[model samples]
Target: MERERMVRKTEIVQVLRMKEGTGDTSFAKTAYMARQILLMTKSIREKVMKELYYCMEQPKILCIADLGCSSSVENNLMSVVYGLIDTIDKARRELGHGPQEYQIYLNDLPGNDFNTVFSSVTRFKDNLKEKMGDDFGDCFVNGVPGSFYGRLFPTNSLHFVHSSSSLYWLSQVPEGIEDNKRNIYMAKTSPPKVLKAYYDQFKKDIWMFLHCRSKEVVDGGKMVLTLLGRQNSDPCYSNRTGYMWELLATVLDNMVVEGYIEEEKLNTFNLPIYTSSPSELEFLVHSEGSFALDQVHASEISWDANDHKNRSSCDQYDFAICLRAVVESLIVSHFGEEIIDEIFKRYREIICASMAEEKNSVDYITISLTRKSRG
Candidate 1:
């Protein structure tokens, strides 16, 4: 049974990806919230760039990797990469350094829409050349398809790494949580064993991630990661992410009761994501022993991606669409495509009803780390 469960997980990983393309219902349209969060951390990224400029000898080429770089026509991976190049170029000029080439690796799982990402590169380069004129060096964009939990780059190849809204996803679902019952994530009703299992799995995955990056990132290189997190220490606390999952589970439960989905299927499924606390992240980084913690900051944003004072039904619908863009693929893979529209319909209603009573917000944790010299 355990072997069978592992195989199931392998299959899920193989198919896991965000909804593709530039349509209204696609991840590209729904990712404005993620883009905002990335923009919020722009200052920290600038600081990292400045430090990188001062710390290392001016290289002819600067190599950067954006792990889990999902595809989008606008306001997505390419936007962030372009912003980084601008930051780098500005810093070089400020420091009186010569123009340098850039090698940007846009990485995500194999299931990602690489064609869309690749198709945008020519326009991206043309825009850069137009903007920077002779100051713009040869900027190369490449797509890397693989899991970030393992090695993806050559030894000491990357000088900087950035990931946003991605690390919360585990390499696989946590094992030994079949008894989590109706919950798809750690909840107040979850057994203590379930919480431990989730945390342990995160620990294992994060440690392996750090170990792999340690081999690939140059000493003194910097990494900035941002993901959904909780300020509260208890795993079962009713944080916004947990509450959202609870609402999703509630919808699935109703579907099962109405015979729309199999009870056994709902019983065995769990999301391959975990929200970590600041302390938990700090502990893992210290234990990994490769990266020195530079800074960790936690901030909250409204779940509806609007001002709390003036949220409307339209905001609720947009929130539902955003959530669907992220998890619809997983739901379809597990239950079937027939239920996608119905599930999200009920999910949107539930969210609207719930928000009528109280506002919902999620905390985002951003951490910056510098690779320490090998002992």
Candidate 2:
């Protein structure tokens, strides 16, 4: 295995957030990613709720954590929290248990726009009051700022853990193999060393994540995670998972040709992302020893899946905006802010051209894990 290299916490926190604000650049304004997250996690979410019902022998207070929960204005975080609560509440009624209070923790990198997240609480609370009336159990939501690669809570503190579209982000760009020339991610053309570097980083990060969660979750606790992934077992299946990035790379390469970007700069740029296969996830779970893989579900969603408002035509510019909200900060940090607009403009054209020949898509994996009982 390659030795681990850390992307400074300060650096990660600063560049990782969606463009913050309530306008066109803001992630809060984009509903596509949020909608798709809910759609993809629907099944395991219910599974986790069912597991929570049986695990909660004394259902007075339940502690739940949402990791990598970026800020959103649609009150997406609270909706998820409430959804979990509703599921648990329904299960409680069915199991002959009484009402219960909840201690919900919403976690993200320290640089996330938590002010926006906290502001939604008032509306969230108001909605709960209207929905449950006097029967509403107390729900307290707090923001936890840190990475999940290490312990973030007290031992035996969590009952359920949920993450969506987050884990595939490696803690850092793989260190030993930075010479993945002319590519921002592990493409089919990426060298074997590049592939091994990403695999090592992902394996290390997942193992550390499981190790920390094992100590924090009580026996039989459940974790549900939805990650950007591919159905193919090979990490180098470019068409399956790397097409979007590949397209983005094409835009950059074209810019380099036109002398709009420095060729040297393009050579050094690499995206710190890895999409794992289900077999890889299963292997990590079994090797970690503290978690048992209960389910692995894979599905393909359109590249423009989140552009619900423009579903009829599937415009590439709309998809560019969605991608911009999530990745603009990183791109700006690497390539400078001045080129941001031009880059996406060209990227939109590339996407539009490609759509005629190929309908771009990405795969997702939703997995449920049960905490192993300690001997």
Candidate 3:
């Protein structure tokens, strides 16, 4: 794992297939996020709705944006958006609030596949139109394809901001990391250089996100973010906390060494892996001075948990399902189709072995911040 690696994988199987966030591969996982959002803030959300009810009475129009809304409209993303949108409409209707005009900006990097997001949003808007029947009111939706690290909109212009399952990704790895070509990221033993590089990059990315949002958010604007995270830091990925992709990466690496695939094909491609807790996130955001931290909730979205327990002992069989689809897809895209089967087989064996050794837990941190009203 180079500190500063850029995506250059030429393999067809693994190219552009890595699971970056709460990916759509798992139906159960996706549903969990939708449900978790409701459960995590049932009371708080109710209060917000009440506030909005009064706010809707004002003559001022509302503007909201979902930053880093990557072009890929995964099933999970769509469900969350539609669910959120539906909830908002219900809030307005309950207050007898006729169409409080809202402008929603769906943002993502320019290189993202916007076709999928645009196509899906268009269809979703059509569905809404059919239901609303000429009473669409003032809600308008459009895609903003660009990076969020820079100012994408005017200051003091937004009323609300939402980024679900985004952030935690560094804008770039530390400089000169890839140049070393030492594979410092992957080592049997702890390497201080590699660890520092990874941590430093994470810190920088966090700052970029905070600074970027701080620049664009209006006074008193609210931002709700749901993203993947880890309970404790162990670069080893030993926690087995739904770290299927990491397992899959090991599988891919093994396949390459076994002569199942060419190693050179993978160096070109890189996947952004980020895991942090709610407090850690708050620290970074607060440090940026753009947003005032308000509420923080830890949602228990572990798929393998029993009785919906936030922490569940890892089981090899159940864990395999979560990791297989994601890892295999990523490998196929980056490493070519030749080693897909081998990679999967090896990955399965390793995951099972790890599970047999002991227990694992999966969890996510949701942080809600109120953007500081600009001076």
CA lDDT, candidate 1, residue 282: 99
TM-score of each: 0.95, 0.93, 0.72
State how far residue 343 of model 2 sits from its true place (Å): 0.6
lDDT of 2 by residue, 191-295 (tens): 999999989989999999999999999888899998889888788764476788888998998899998899888888888788999999999999999998989
Q: Model 1, 4-60: lDDT tens per residue?
A: 867865776687888898788888777656766777788887688778867888887
Candidate 3: Cα lDDT at 287 = 77
Clashes of each: 0, 1, 20
Could you give candidate 3's per-residue lDDT for residues 184-277 as a string of tens digits? 2333243556556766667777787778777776666667776667655665455333355456556656656777656665443344445675
Specify the highest-lDDT model's number. 1
Name the regions of candidate 1 deviating beyond 4 angstroms: 1-9, 308-314
TM-score of 3: 0.72
lDDT of 1: 0.85
Cα RMSD to native, each candidate? 2.3, 2.6, 5.8
Error of 1 at 173 (Å): 0.9
